[model samples]
Each structure stands twice: as C-alpha cells, then as structure tokens.
Target: MTTKKLTWVSMLLAMCVLGANFKLLGSIALDSFPAFLGAMILGPVYGAFLGIAGHFVSALLAGFPQTLPIHIIIGFLMGICMFIFGLVRKKAMGDGIMVKAVSWLIAYIVSVPLNLLILYPVLHEVVFVLFVPLTIATLANLLISELVYAVLPSKIKNFGQSKVV
Candidate 1:
C-alpha cells in the first residue's frame, strides 16, 4: 500500500477502536461505522481487516466476552458483504442513495441468515433477542457509513479509490 493508503488504514483502525467503545441504539455498535467507512473508502479488503481486528480488540479491551467467535464472525461477514455490495453499487449504480441503501440492505440480508446459523450454535439464546440487536447494530452501521461518505471531502474520499473497492 502507498503511504496515503497506509495512513488511512491506520486512522480507520483507530476510529474502529474508539468507536467500538460507544454502543448505542441497543446493539448498534459504533465500531461498524469505521469498518464500513474503511471499506467504502479504502475498499472491501481493508474494511474486513478493520472489522475483524476491531471486533477482537474491542472485545479484548472490554474484558473478552464469552461470545468472541460470534462477534468475529459477524465482523468478517460484515466486511465481505460490504465489499461485494460496494462492487455492485459502484459498477451498476455509480454512487447514489439507492446504492448505499441497497448495499447496506443486502449486507444485512446476507449476514442475518448466515449469522443465525452461527449464533444458534454458539450463543444458544432465543433467536429473536439476538436477532433484534444484531439487526439494530447493523442498521446503525449502515446509516453511519452513509453519513461519513456525505461528510468527507472529495480529495480524501477519492484518495485511494484505485487501490481497492
């Protein structure tokens, strides 16, 4: 990666680390914003890296909860789906509200079922309870990503576009 991209990756990781601390709207972890932003700006691979690492780091700092695997898996899935949707959004839609909405919507759609499979086996809680929180958190992440995109400068926004995503 170039110096610029490396710098962004570092910055986003810090954002993810800090954001992970402030959860709101029930399960809506703030960490998702940094991860999604990283993906949207730097591309999917970096997003995934931030997600996986951020989730773990947050958990570690927060006392290493028992539900470690679930969080990690969710993070991984979030990155993957975001990358895929981003590609489709960029190619077919060419950056618009619908693209953001659908990309996020699809990320949630793809993650829920897959996550359910993992959640059931690991957490062993009532499906609805876990499902609701996850949904809220994911949705929050999506909205934040869109907001970040809107607020960012064009120069910074377009900085590393050719490198990834």
Candidate 2:
C-alpha cells in the first residue's frame, strides 16, 4: 500500500476502535461504518480487514460475552459480509439517482440472508431477536458510508483505488 492508503487505513481503524463505545447488543455495536466506508473507498479486501478487526474490537470491549471462539467466528462472518457488500457496491456503481437509490436498497437488503445463513444454525430462534438491531446497525453503517463517500473529494475517492473494488 502507498503511504496515502496506509494513512487512511490507520484513520479508519482508529475510527473503528472508537466506534466500539457505541454498543448495541453484546459485542454488536454501531462500529461497522468504518468497515463499510473502507469497502466503498478502498476495496473489498480492506472492507474485510476492517470488518473483522472492527468486530473484534467491539467484542473485546464487551469482554467477549459470546465467548472468544464464537466472536472470532462472528468476526470472520463480518469479513464475509463486507466482502459481498463491496462486490455488490462495485457492480452497482454508476450515474443517475434511481441507480443510486437501487444500490443503497440492495446494499441494505443483501445483509438479511447473510446474517441468517450462518447465524440461524448457531443462534436458531435467537437470530430473530437480533434481526432488527443488526439490520438497523447495517443500515446505519451503510448510510454513514454513503454520506461520507458522497462528500469526499474525487481525488480521495479515487486514490489507491486502481485494480480494487
């Protein structure tokens, strides 16, 4: 990575660490914005890195209420989620308000099955209880990413983005 990309990664990681303070449930916090933003601006790989690290930080802060192994699994799942999210957003990129709206809608909708797929067997019915809050967290995270990405300078958005999506 270039110095610029490294710097931005550091900044996002810092933001993710700070975001751990806003806990929603157990280790689940509103800390995913940085990861989502990383996905948008950096790429899917960075998104996975931030997502796993971000969740780990939140889990750490919460004393690993769900146990370290489970949290580790969750962190990996978060990584997968970020990867898919980045891929979808990459394909969805374009001009037009309708396209933008559709992209946002798809980003939000994409999380449902991913959350349920792995979580259902582990969480069973308990996944239902978290669906709302996790969905809300995902919405908040994507909104923050969209808002930030919208305001960023073109140079910054395009920086270190070559061969990345």
Candidate 3:
C-alpha cells in the first residue's frame, strides 16, 4: 500500500476500535462502519484486514481474547458482504441505501449462527432475539459511514479507485 493508503487504513482501524468501545443500542457497537468504508473505498482485501486487525486490537484492549474469533469472523463477513454489495447490483451500489442494507443483512445473517453457536455461552444470556438491535445498530453504522463518505470531495472519495482497478 502507498503511504496515503496506509494512513487511511490506520485511521479506519482506529475508528473501528473506537466504535466498538461505544454501544449505541444495547450492546451493539458501530464498529463495522469503518470496515464497510474500507471495503467501499479500498476493496474487499483491505476491508478484511481492517476488520480483522480492528477486532483483534479491540479484543485485546478490552481484555477479552477468548471471544476474538467471533468478532474477527463478523468483521470478515462484513468485508465480503460490502464488497459484493458495492460491486454487484446494477443500480443501487456505491452510496445507495440498498447497498448498505444488503451488506448489513448479509453480514448479520451470517453472524447469527456464528454468534449463537460459539459466543452464546460467553454472553451467558439468550442470544436469538438480539438480532433486532444488531440490525438497527448495523444500519446506523453503515448510514453514518456512508454519509461521511458521501460528503467527502469526489477526489478523496475516489482516492483508491485507481489503485483498485
């Protein structure tokens, strides 16, 4: 990666960690937004790196390494989903709400089983119904990230596209 790309990746990784530190709805955090931004701007590979590193760092900072796998998997799924949403759909990609919705839904759908099967005992509570809050938090995360990306100057928003292509 170029110096500029590395800086942006570092910034986004910090954003994810900070986002994870704050719970907007129940226990759901806005951490995935930065990962989505990475995916939308830098592509799936960088996005996955952001998600993985961000989750790992956050887990360590929070002193909960045991659940690292769960968070890591969620971030990986977010990257893949965002990549597909942005590159697929003919009309509703980029900053379109449909893209965000699709990405969030796909990521969340994949996360549920993973969370239920592995992280359930860790949380020590019923886990199935939390999807509602998770969905809302995810929507909020993507909306905030997309809005920020939308407002950036076109040049900056298109920063990594040339490199990507």
Candidate 4:
C-alpha cells in the first residue's frame, strides 16, 4: 500500500480505538487507554488526531473542563513526541522491546508537563502531591500501551504500515 493510504487507514483505526477507549473507560488517562500507542503506531498527524478527538469526545461526554484548548495542546505535544518515536522506529524498523521502551520513555517525558500544566489546573487540583502519582500513572500507561502495540499480531502491525506511494 502507499504511504497516504496507510496513513488514512491508521487514522481511521486510531479514531476507532479512541472511541472505544472513551466509551469503555470514560477517561483519557490510563483508566481508558494511552493515546501514545496510537501516535507511535500511526504517524504523528494521525496520532494527534486520535489524541485530540478522543479527548474532545470524552470531555464532552464526561464533562471535562477546558476540553478544547487543553486537549489540543496535549495532543499536539504528544503527537510530536510520538512522531519522534515513529522516526526512530522507522530508522530501526524493528519490532523489539528496546524500541517500545524508548517510545514509552519519550511519551512519558512529553506527557508530564502537558498533564501538570494543562490538565491539572483544569481539573482544579494542585500539582503538589498529585504530580508524582500522575507522572507515574502516565508513564505506566504509556509503557503498557506501547507494549500492547509492539506485541500485536502481524495483521494489526500491517494496519500501521505506511503506504505513502
């Protein structure tokens, strides 16, 4: 398949996953699922769409505060971070644990400030004691998500392969 077709397919799959996540879990956090995996598997742009669209829909349904701006920023940053992972993966082009680990690390690092600055304030919680736990949770979620994606069957992996020809 061509890269463009692959991207569109990935985006569609990401959106479906995002919707299922929100519907089943009710939040955009680890409770539902991590957006980072989608970002990592699909390219940054598709990943960003997944993150932003997922959060926006979840917020509307769950009554989350400052939905648009916060999610937009978070999605964009997370996408950029995941894009880095995608680039690295493209270079390595390997489905190994090391790649997954690095991708998780990148997602966690990017999510920390985004959550602390953009999300916490909206939730009306101080970033004092909550910061550490939140960071840990975010990291954990990213790791689990990456692991899930990395170990997916070949059919699923094929879903993410770029067809930009």
- Local distance difference test, each candidate: 0.70, 0.78, 0.64, 0.56
TM-score versus the correct structure, for each prediction = 0.82, 0.85, 0.71, 0.62
Runs in model 2 lying further than 4 Å from the true structure: 93-110, 162-165
Query: lDDT tens digits, residues 28-130, model 4?
Result: 4443233455555555555555555555555565555445666566556555655665566655657677876676566666666655666565656654555
lDDT of 3 by residue, 118-140 (tens): 55675546566666666676677
Worst 10 residues of 3 by lDDT: 85-94
Select the stronger candidate by TM-score from 3 and 4.
3
Output the TM-score of candidate 3: 0.71
* Model 2 Cα lDDT, one tens digit per residue, 62-86: 9988678878877888887787766
- Stronger candidate by lDDT (3 vs 4): 3
TM-score of 2: 0.85
Clashes of each: 1, 0, 0, 7
For residue 29, give model 3's deviation from the true position in Å.
Answer: 1.3
lDDT of 4 at 8: 54
Best by lDDT: 2
Please report how far candidate 2 places residue 55 from its true position, in Å. 0.6
The 10-residue segment with the lowest total lDDT in model 2: 156-165
* Cα lDDT over the full model 3: 0.64
> What's model 2's overall lDDT?
0.78
